[model samples]
Target: METTFVGRHVEIAQVARLMRESRLVTLTGLGGVGKSRLAHRVVEESVAEFPDGLWLVELACLTDPHLLPETVADVMGLADQPARRRAEVLAEWLGPRRSLLVLDTCEHLVEAVASLVDTLLRAAPRLRVLVTGRQPLGAPGEHVYSVPPLPVEDAVALLRERAGLAAPPDGSGGEGGAAELAELCQGLDRIPLAIELAAVQLRTLPPTVLLRRLNDRYHLLTGDGGPVRHGSLRAAMGWSHELCTPAERLLWARLSVFASGFDLEAAEYVCAGGPLPAGQVLEALTGLADKSLLQREEHPTGVRLRMLDTVREFGAEWLSRLGEDSAVRGRHRDHYLRLARRCATEWPGRQVEWYGRIRAERRNLRKVFELCLADPQWSRAGLDLAGTLWFLWVCCGMSREGRHHLETALRADPGPGPERLRALWVCAWVAALQGDLAAARERLDQCRAEDPEGSVTGHVLQVEGMLALLRRDHARAVELLEEAMAWHMAKGGVLSGLLPCHALAALGLLAAGRPAEAVETLSEGQALCEVHGEEWSRAQMEYVFAWAGHVEGEASGALRHARSALASALGFEDLSLSAACVEMIAWAVTEEGDAGGGAWLLGVAQAVRDSLGLPRSGSGIFAPVREQTLTQAVKVLGGAGFDTLFAEGQGSDLGIAVKYALGEKIS
Candidate 1:
């Protein structure tokens, strides 16, 4: 999708012309000067010339320069080949393909990106590289374009567009409005970002009032003999910062602690303190947004506020100068810590909402985890946070990230404790998902040893049961799961472990070929989930119920449960669950005498799995069902017919696949 670009036609045309004339075009500008936006505009305009496609690799979040080549390869969908260097793999993949590669935010990793780009440009003659940064990549034959701030007229146009305000009525004697806007834009150096920030204030403040405040602040700061930094974006930002009330400034600085955007409640929880009272947080937040320090975004879940990187950096500097860095960070960690715990606690009944909330806070959660692991005193907190998000990571197909955070926390805080014990089991769950049985076993053993008789023992047992199932020890898995379920139920509270216990126990029964018992078990679990409004675990249980119904030769019953499972899975965007549901639906359709439909859905399921980089073995419990379904569909449809239907399914997108699974005919 193309991002909305305003007031960059001239720059776009120039950059596009430069791109066609040279294989390398670098857009250089100061922070927040719209270099990235210009590059994006140029790429969009010139994309038709490159039939191979255009790929954007964002380096803002990437800190390790060593992974530059791998990051590029991953973005290009080029998997690593055994014994082949990543750069070599990338070059070979790009060779013979005419493509445009955009390397964004390269100032921090300029050397590494420059070297990689140089190599690729030499190896792949048809490749074009467009880069955005504060400086040039310095590669040979690099055409550098210095992007400037918007012209006064264009800046005013952009301000009006972004602020949702129309230009003052042409001849209504509202010329004053135009003059004020021009002055505000000039005050902000005609920088697109700064002008937009100032313009948003039109929602809450009159343009005249905003202009007055800016002038007052500028006059106060630029006293006699001070060389005016009118063209400095930082100076404009600082002036805007100075106009904020003390509470607004404090909130702005504290809000910098977040790695991504956050909502009002998070701001209140993290930024409220001695000077900034919690009661005033809402007002202060609105004030900051009006001043353009915070960007207000409307999301499906709720409205969120974000600080631009440059604004956030300025806030960080102020925070450091205020000497409240450590304390504010502590509050930041505590807030996300509480957030993680709440998500875990509420996940049983509010699974969909919790999933969205947690996804939104992922960047902040990562920041908190880093803060916890980096400080000796906060390592335990970090471990606790990581342990709390086990379900999000494991069930949501983020096992790799989950494992990385868990291992890092465990290494930093290996001391024996309840937190450490919890971290171990969570780590075990993630490791098992990755098919690392040995690591799973070791972590489970460590967890068991640390909390043999505590509340966490039930969780430990559940992990062990899951590992047993993975190893195909049906009886042992059944025994462990039953024991864990009973223990949690006896404890009488709504234990988070209960849901997993139910899931694994049902899977164990199915594995043992006791389809009826498995169906009954999962049915009860599903009933309980409905009572609690827990969609995540219920989705998985429904899939199991579908599988059990298939085993019992009840095609209609299996199809019903599979459809229910798919609705929940797609709602949560859980790819693994969706894949499993698709497979079960395919089997049920085959049993219902639609061999072509079954083959098509099987192809869709395989596509979903491949998109996630999951191996066929990743669907451990459902592998037999998938295999049987494929064999039967082939037998009924014949090889040629099956291949054509399967290809049709493979070519379908998620929306089409879902429609087909739900019994809609695909044209």
Candidate 2:
């Protein structure tokens, strides 16, 4: 567990000096050449110079560039506000603070990180950034530092340190041992990661034997006198890979299917089959980790293994060469598909836990989606996968990405089936959330054409009802939702549409000026969810229940329901529903004669919407209510008092806003 940085003092000092002189310092080098390690050393030495302290944002697990700003803000402990762009908020927060922001692994998201860094440097005069990647950010006035591999002496020293500890004391340390270690480092091109990997082998192999096997592997792999850095690194990897038992090599290649780190169970599930039986996966995985092909780390849930991108690429190449790439990819896709289905199925009863699991595997799901859509044969499966993840996309605020993948899969595979029908309806839901009613309608029409009498008819009807509600056709919306609910109740299958049907029906009834009926409908939905142990749609039903109570002059009851809804929505990260709950709480408070509190809550709702990148449309079920609340609040609090309260709400944290909505006094 004690990992010591070896032989980078001069590089670290030089980088530290460069950072002090430059606003942005980018440490660029080949993979496994120790760029990340050097950056860590430099930051460790230089962090005390900044008053605000140093912050490291690891980008290796981030797959979506669109989330870069939000990710950074989250790391900086910024609350999600719906009223402003995350990037603008982040810049404002960092503007007066003197700190160093270290962005690790920017190569995959170079453009996003560069753009963000550019904006931050312009807005935050006192802020500096340090980036580690295979390439430079190439920003204005940026300083690029190329990290070279360790010199022979330092490489030997690192090897000796690791080897000395790992090797038996009596079996190590002689002039011959030193010579063999030096030759091994030379063969590995002095790359610190490669050297360390080779050093660990000394635990099992003597220096002489290790060097001989490495030489044999290098002779078999090297050709054409390639660049020393590239050839040596590749040869070292090949040697290490060759050292693995056949089962271990198979697992190593299969592990490349994962886009991020995974635990043992996941590896066993996805990579175990044929030559590598499920029973042997753990042993093979441990073997690979022992040889440093897989990096193991402890997580809150369990120990996870990760392959460096470079090593993964090598394994992937071998996988393709062995012609098992497609087979392994199929298994990978199947495993994640099962995972998504499980999350969706369990989300109702275990909302928070399922949400976290889905979030953790989001990258792998993306890879599954990509692989499925890229092949015509698997296009239907891709559509099914995308449709199944509708909850994660719509309720979890991944509307944009959900739309992208859905649209791609839809375009690629227009073949008619139950999967396509489901995808069409899911696509419509995403479109409706984005305010593209035309697109939503078009997709619904396509679903209807595909199978008006099929199982997806209920979902299609629910989507139509949603569109009707958004367009203010409340009566028609209610009728459609009721019909969908009845159809789903009769069907009673695994893909039953009960949740969406009930939730939308309640909203439709509420929108039609029938609060009493809406309350009854929501109660029915709540009872159904409770019977089934589902919570996903219950949050939205709770919001509508709050509005129903508010309409019926039950202010205290409305406040209770609103708070409950907000808590559930926040638990699931359902931003839109949370904002609606806030608005409902504001309405109730205003009705109770607390106009100042109501105005502030209203402002918080606006901020939440702004942070989520949702536009304020003049039409909707709550638009008139919102207008009335704002007018009443302003009239009671007066213009000056209202502005002050609104400003306070705008700057308040989301948690504070929630507490205020629940009638807690602010400190």
Candidate 3:
């Protein structure tokens, strides 16, 4: 795949045409038949046709078919915060968008994939799915396109390009060479993978020698393979495996445990020791890459490696034979468990980097999450791990996904412990955020019942306060929030909750129409945040302060505080908080006498909420401002003028809008 793509123009065109006439297109072929590459090529050619953009979900990394929809949701950047099923969330979010979703490597999960595709298609009428596998998904209206092996000329060209040779020794730049190369491709069955595998052996063996070796291997495979095209690819793959050193072979088998491409540190830790030796993993990894059995990709963090699915399957078969599947999986799980804890520890300081790091490893983390939840022995670890990821799920707009894992863990282990107690509170927190008051209360009740001694006193109080505020019970909310803040002050707060308690209490105070007291509470919270060098909670407090100032009828002062909060929100990149700040600024703008500017900000806020599927702040504390601002703008500028300005805001890039709102020069 590192080399230039040599063929498949016809197939790409055919698939492109199929897409125009169909919603589901399945590219089916034999192993190593280039279906995945072909699917990507087709999407690239017609990408501009879809307005919602193209998303490629690599299904080979998934071990659990049940996660099919979650994987799709993750790829689409949909914040899975709603308490509904993941497929429902995906359907609602994608229903009105024109998008192309490519699900790659579906041979193992055809049934699940088909079921998901059926549901998604029924709900999201404008959505299109392109699938790649050895067989069809068989969903309604699915157009099946059989990806063929490279034809004669393209096969020779591919082999020659992959080998990087001017001419084969047997062909010497003439009709003789053309005949020789064609026959070589024919001997390898003209399959792209088979030809590529054969090309690598040309480094040490001449064309004639490699051809003879391939023919011998092909005939030997004929007994079991029975003249199928797969026999040719299998023969080449076996030869490639034989080319690898024993250590490299063993490393390949162990590396198969990684759900996705992994960095060198992961491979060294998971695939080391025993006969392979820890110190030699890198050397063996390099050997596999040199033989074209695995690929190396350069990333900003570091170099990561991955093998093709065919190669990974071959290694998996070897691993099954060696009976180290359980041991390797255990090592993989333990490594990620440690990494998850480290991510949680580092998130306080590296909020921005934390988001990037977790997203890069999300597929692997999901696999680990599923493994632990599925096994009773690992259920407790799952409970703790799910709770530990509260920041990722809540702050990152993935609250729905967070709830998914937590619900699974909570169901798997029902007992009395600090882990279960903390998980209950975290689940309730997200549930309330999504407007599921009943579920939120149920989880909170569970939390209290499980921990009779109240180990998570502050956590429970804060969520109760949040739920009350969302329900517009201002007096009760204020009282509960005060208790949470007092407990936080007494015990010295923990990450996200300690200082955030002040922000939650401040919001409750604002809801109760007490802006003056809210300021006093936020001042102390902001100072504590500054002391800890934390901006996430500090930004939240600033956002609450801006709203409080606005509620107290101080337009300019509230704009100042809101601007500062918006800058910080942009830095940390929380969609919901950023939208809240934008909405606050709109209120300040209208109060300061710029009705048109306020209208534009309203549009931007609406766009942000729609794009990320975020609900209103505190369930609707500022909800009245939206209508009031729009009415004022329409009265001052007329319906047509207001519409034009509002549309501009909707069309403008979010970063530019933020800069515009901050009074910075827009270039």
Best-fitting candidate, scored by lDDT: 3
Q: How many clashes in candidate 2? A: 11
lDDT tens readout by residue for model 1, 493-555: 344678768888998998898877786888788778778877778878888888778788888
Cα-lDDT of candidate 1: 0.78
Candidate 2: worst-modelled 10 consecutive residues by lDDT:
77-86
**TM-score, cand. 2:** 0.83
Q: Kindly give the stretch of ten consecutive residues in candidate 1 with the minimal lDDT sum.
A: 77-86
Off-target runs (Cα >4 Å) in candidate 1 are 1-5, 16-26, 39-131, 135-146, 151-190, 195-231, 452-455, 492-495, 664-667
RMSD of 1: 5.6
lDDT of 3 by residue, 316-429 (tens): 877877999999989999888888888888876677777776767777888898889879999999999899888877777677678888898999999778889989999999
| Global local distance difference test of model 3 | 0.81
Q: Give the poorly placed runs of model 2, Cα more than 4 Å off.
A: 1-24, 40-103, 108-130, 137-141, 150-189, 205-217, 224-229, 297-303, 342-348, 452-455, 493-496, 586-604, 616-619, 624-645, 652-667
User: Model 2, 1-667: lDDT tens per residue?
Assistant: 3378788878988898898899999999988899888888888888678876478887876777866876676566443333225576577666666889999989999999999999988998999999999898889989999999898878887887876643335444663355667787887889987787776666667767876776666666665454444766776677677678999988888998789888777898889989999999999998988777878887544577898877887888779878999888888888888888887777656767777767777678878887887788888889999888887777776676678778888898988787788788888988887677899999988888889567677788888888898888989999998888888887883223777677778877777788778778788888887887766677777777777776777888888888888888877677777778888888888988899888888888876666555555333866766787888898998899988998777666677788777667879
Q: List TM-scores for all candidates, in order.
A: 0.81, 0.83, 0.91
Query: Between which residue pairs do clashes occur in model 1?
Result: none
Given candidate 3, what's the lDDT at residue 72?
83
User: What's the lDDT for all of these models?
Assistant: 0.78, 0.79, 0.81
Model 3 collision count: 3
